[model samples]
Target chain A: MQPVAPSLRRKPTVMSLLARFAWLPLCFVLVGCHIDMYDQPKYRPNRPSDFFEDGRSMRPPVENTVAMGSFEADSALFTGRLNGELAVDLPMELTADLLERGQTRYEAFCAPCHGLAGDGNGVIAYRGPLQVPTLHNDRLRTVAIGYYFDVITNGINRMYSYAHRIPPEDRWAVAAYVRALQLSQNVDADTLTAEERALLGGP
Target chain B: MSAQIFSRNANAILLVSIAAIVLLIVGIISALIGLYLSPWYTGVGDAIEQPVPFSHKHHVDQLMIDCRYCHSTVERVAHAGIPSTDTCMSCHSQIWTNSPLLQPVRDSYQTGEPVLWNRVYDLPDFVYFNHSVHVAKGIGCASCHGRIDQQHLTAKAQPLYMGWCLGCHRAPEEHIRPRDEVFNMAYEPQMMPIADRLALVQEYQIPVDGRLTHCYTCHR
Candidate 1:
């Protein structure tokens, strides 16, 4: 049999080698094309109106001050309506029912911040630098029920709103309890009758 | 003689090629059958039996009690919470005072612990289902939860897939009604017609086509 020609054999070998090398760039091009298409940043539309007016993305606008419409002067429902004006009517005497409801509401909501004795020494108030005012202080005592309701609903400077956690009626109940605390601490000595004065060991 | 050797080589190659083709065909068929028909290829389809044989049918159907009576937080919170022991005791304490069924309630109260009720209608951990939104909509509890009122023991009545949720959310206005009638199964719209409902759904731009099928929608 005739021996195979070296040139012919080399031609087939070289062609196979060239064909193998040609796939390198092709493979890279395929991978690069896919990466370019899929890995690119997607286009998103810019719509300023989608953002909240308060600049907060998630939260609704904070109503820092009470609006006039929210207050219900004679509505009997002490629970202040949401986004309504704050109303106030001071009864001369706090009833037992009012005090009881107030106390229950206080323990649930305020006691966590304003300590059991109405001192500013609540666990959270004491632990944090934010000075939650004591109920014994004249600043808190002189504030109207409406003012207290506003603070509870809207939250004071450092405090967060308890509106979502406590119902509207409960805020009024808490305000009533704060009044009771003030009265208990700062009672008028002259208002007592002779029998009451004698019981108090007063002249 | 050379031709014979070449023929033998060709025959051998042909035999090998035929064997390889047969193997490939068999492999392809096996894969196709496994993909479409073989049940073993399916993952975790077994229904787990719960601890207590609590019947949704008895409570929801026989007693005619609403789903919210037990899962009360469905109207207010993200979860349609399992009823607290006190909630069970509210009825069980008086109604089934002597039954062995009340033992679980008594046990929970005595231990001062909640019954770790086995979850029946569990979605994938990724889905963020807000029971309040659904309850607030006119979607009846039965719409997705299936005929839970008819079951003796409440197994998962619905598959609760993404397609299942999108089927309603895509056209929520069609399902919408007065807020008060949100949970009412027998709610009938008096003021709004079907066209109005459809329009409201469009106006709200309710998500259709299941495009909001993002990982974050359900999962954190």
Candidate 2:
């Protein structure tokens, strides 16, 4: 190893130690604020609130305030009601395409609780106390299509409302499909088309 | 001073100290890198310890039960909701009535207390994922969850990072299926004759442009 030059070999003086350690205090003061983006002042889901009277973070929508494009000009179509009673007929026209769309939506949404055949033996109903009522039954079969729409829009007994998930058009479609399922199961053989009748061995 | 600083045995000591410091820094960096890439941190293919061992393979593959049967809120809720104890007892009540494995489920049914299932595909708090939107958009469960029907114990099939999400958001056609076959696990895509597949994408009303690729689509 090379020997240090006489000039470089300085004595360890108190002043030198102070000069060498001058950056220590500056280091303490220079730690800039590191606010983690995730840990910032924010409200999480279902967090309680001091601002609301109810103390819930989720606030109820202002009463009677209509959302843009969601204004229900036709009360019958949105609510299935005409003068505080369930309407007899659907506000919208029923078509083959509408029935098909209804079938798809119904299968996805309703088939879990209401069986694919409307027998109320859906995969979920088989579980425990969550008994789903059958659409093919007399009480449901005689009810207006609008009644089904109403019940779907605003749930009944143990069944939660599906209003948010099922659009109005789809809700009407589902009601139509439920009617179709009811008819298909309860239909007389004489009412079938000749080809359909023959297919069912009813010729 | 004691024989002057850096004078006797100073060079050897200085070299050793410098080497030790370098080793320590390297060790720390490597450890961090290793930890970040490890399965413990990334949770890739790691089957979490759930309260009860529910096999998707048995229900989905063997019995051929639809996914929506148990995940009742997949098409409506933000998260694909877990099955209630009642849903399990629906089948297990008749079949596995007395099995020791299903004791917790039976107990949960007897008592209203929920089964605290540990989530496997956990994302950071920042990622706001909506299941209904994706399912409605015709994105199949397999797209993100991988072949869940084959998994005995459910695991995080993908990294589920922002980059992984963007890969599909950038081009969803490859993953898009006919809406009819969305629940069909056996269905596979054939984009080889590219025109037909591209047409199918349009037919399904799939949003393919910058609409889903935006950061706000998922983050906010």
Candidate 3:
């Protein structure tokens, strides 16, 4: 095609070009305003779901299905029982580190109700207007180590199950620490070394 | 004949119109940028109301409870697990059994429904953040959560802008603390000497080879 004269052909003036595309900024504004990417339809942790019956995005495990590597139902470590009776000792070796770990876990999970010294004087017990049993009592002091694990796992009258919070190994650790706490409060002065007796004062 | 058709003031009026248009564009852009950065848009410090008005200050600062007491899976998982209704009733069943403030919690426990807490510090869906990696790498909870233990009502402490993330990824040594001190809200990052901080970065095996800043590091 032959080219037309410059003036004869239509030319886009700046104003006309701008008028043609005036909605460009509006598009940018609208696109920027949408938060679809920030809040996608996909579920993240704890997001509520309308599709599920319980409205929870997460689902509970199937009934009676044991998880992998957790099938040891008969072991004293898992059941806190030896044959028909509660085991009187830990299934694993006790170390200072284990005691320290037990102390930390105890302070976090148990001390709130049982008292740090197992004297039933925790802040929750005091404010709870409830009488928590003292671990120093003769019955609890003489109870088998597995009894503590069972109590922690199954919970007693007013106490709820802590199985979800403290795992089996930690339960054993706490049992050992509870035994230590009993010994601490029930120790005889004659059993103490000269240095330890002095530390207790009243020479 | 056409030369004198327009008035003499038209030139000045045209110039004024151009300047006004330029100023308008600049003003609009600036206003939008300002809005984007504002607390209203970023949701920084705005405490979203929850079904129950749970106070971190009371539970953490007053009670001295460990962070792991509730957020038990923070050390092992990508998401810090929220406490179940049973976790609440663990203590509430003993104390505060009659308080109206805990009614939702009690109701949830009885009804087997989950308490719906308003989401705080929700990063964009595109971002993949792992709580375990951060904790394992010695990033303190306060480093990102900003003294959440002190906030009576949970709120967004950081704007969670990509650049803000990059600021830490670029120089992690400045923010890294001892692994034991990760949950200590009062821990000061500067308390540890620079050499020790650098040593910790090395000890934790945090990649200083620009991998932390890669696009896939967060976006994926």
Question: lDDT of all predictions, in order shown?
Answer: 0.61, 0.76, 0.89
TM-score on 0 to 1 scale for chain A of candidate 2: 0.66
**Candidate 2 or 3, higher DockQ?**
3
**Per-model TM against the reference:** 0.43, 0.60, 0.83
The CAPRI category of model 1 is: incorrect
- The true-versus-predicted C-alpha distance at residue B52 of model 2, in Å, is 7.8
Q: Give the lDDT of residue B183 in candidate 3.
A: 88
Candidate 2 error regions (>4 Å): A1-35, A44-74, A124-134, A137-139, A153-169, A188-203, B1-38, B47-133, B148-155, B190-195, B202-220
Model 3 C-alpha lDDT per residue in residues A88-113, reported as the tens digit of each score: 88999999988887887788788887
Candidate 2 lDDT over A1-203, as tens digits, reads 46789999988899999999999988877785454564544555444567866565556478877777664756888889888888888788889998998897788678866889989987667754566777877888888778988887887776656665677888899999988999889988877888898787643
Model 2, CA-based lDDT: 0.76
Residue runs of model 1 more than 4 Å from their true location after superposition = A1-203, B1-48, B169-196, B200-215
Give the clashing pairs for model 3. Answer: none
- The candidate that wins on lDDT is 3
Cα lDDT tens digits for candidate 3, B1-220: 3356568898999999999999999999999999999999999999999988889998888887788888877887899889999988888987888999999999998888888887887788999999999999999999989988899989989998899899999999999999889989999889999999999999999999999999999996
True contacts kept of each: 0.00, 0.07, 0.70
Query: Per-residue lDDT of B1-96 in model 1, one digit per residue for the tens?
Result: 343335548888999999999999999999896675433432223344654567876665655555654664576788776666666654454345
